[model samples]
Structure formats: structure tokens, C-alpha cells
Target: MTNENRFNFNDALLTALFGTPSRKNTIDRLGIVCPVFPDEELRKSAVILCERIKKMDDFSWTALCKMAK
Candidate 1:
């Protein structure tokens, strides 16, 4: 598949962290900032996301998109 169509772990983490791509308003509505949580809190969140990333090889574009919500 072309790079544009690829869905990887990094993309999932970003979506989970930053919310939907190119939907700044939605993110704003959700109150998700770059550092949504404090560093210590974020590290705890990262642990959960890391487990998710390890369990899945990749995700469909639609699945990644849902991560935004």
C-alpha cells in the first residue's frame, strides 16, 4: 500500500493523544491539548497505549480514525 494509506502504531498513538487529524475544532471540543495530561499521568497513559500498540500490528484507516474520539 502507498504511504498515504498506511495505518501504523504511531498513527494510533498520535490520534489517541491529539484527537482527529485536521479536525482541530473537534479536538478543541474534546478539550485535548498536546499535553492532555501531566507528565506522570501521561506516562501511565502511555503504558496502556504501548500495550495496545504491541498487541496490534496495524489498524485500518477507519479504526485509527475512531481513535480520535
Candidate 2:
């Protein structure tokens, strides 16, 4: 996919995986006004996130976001 498309996909995926956090909580915890994927660091972070998610027992959004970071 194109870079734009990939970024869009990643954003959607993260939103779905993490649900929609309360606006204030999200900003405080993640420092993101909206859901986003790591771009320049995608290669390294994606691999780690995927592996961590796969091993998670609960498969929760919070878990996924933690892993993604």
C-alpha cells in the first residue's frame, strides 16, 4: 500500500484495537490528540507490537496500545 494508505490503515487498526479512549485520558496517557501509528519507527515497533499482542491472554485494547508503544 501507499504510505498514506498504510498510515490510514494503521490508524484505524489502532483505534479499533484500543477503542476510543476518553479524550482527556488519551491526551494525558499517550500525548496523542487522535490515534496514530508509529511511522518512522514502524519496522521495529510493528514487529514488537505484533508479537506482544499475539502473546497477550486478554487481547485487550489497552494491552494492544501498550504493546504497540
Candidate 3:
């Protein structure tokens, strides 16, 4: 029902295409420089997280995080 976006998609694309704003621009903007976790690292971390999360009561491997809106 609400957005939790950190950066606008257009701004992100501009940042990717042109890099960060120049000092003359003098305005704050959000952008992606690099992934926080690369593919291998993300896979490993997800494994660990899933292992821990499975210890919770009444959790199921096939369970959906949320139903479709």
C-alpha cells in the first residue's frame, strides 16, 4: 500500500549513466554505485539467514512471505 523506495528509478539511471552529481549541483541524491553484496556473497548470506529463520516456530519452507495484493 506504500512505497519504501530509497531512490527514484530515473535518478538512479541518471547516476548510473553520468555518475554522481558534480559539486556545482549542490543537491543530495540517492544512487547505486555497486551492489552491497555480490552474487556469491548474497547466496552465502541467504543460506545462513534461511538456516536461522527456519528455527522459528511454525515456519515452512514453502510458505509465502505475503499473499499477492
The lDDT values for all models are 0.46, 0.42, 0.31
**Per-candidate TM-score against the hidden true structure:** 0.34, 0.30, 0.28
lDDT of 2 by residue, 1-69 (tens): 444323344544544544333333432333332235446564343444344444445546455445444
Ranking by TM-score: 1, 2, 3
C-alpha RMSD by candidate, in order = 10.1, 10.9, 17.6
Better of 1 and 3 by TM-score: 1
List the candidate 1 regions with Cα displacement exceeding 4 Å.
Answer: 1-38, 60-62, 65-69
Q: Kindly provide the TM-score of model 2 when superposed on the true structure, using C-alpha atoms.
A: 0.30
* Tens digits of per-residue lDDT for model 1, 5-31: 344564456556554433433344234
Our tally of clashes for model 1 stands at 0
Q: Backbone collision count in every prediction?
A: 0, 0, 0
Candidate 1 — worst ten consecutive residues by lDDT sum?
21-30
lDDT of 3 at 34: 24
| Model 3 lDDT on a 0 to 1 scale | 0.31
Worst 10-residue lDDT window for candidate 2 reads 26-35
Q: Give me the displacement of residue 15 in model 1, in angstroms.
A: 2.7
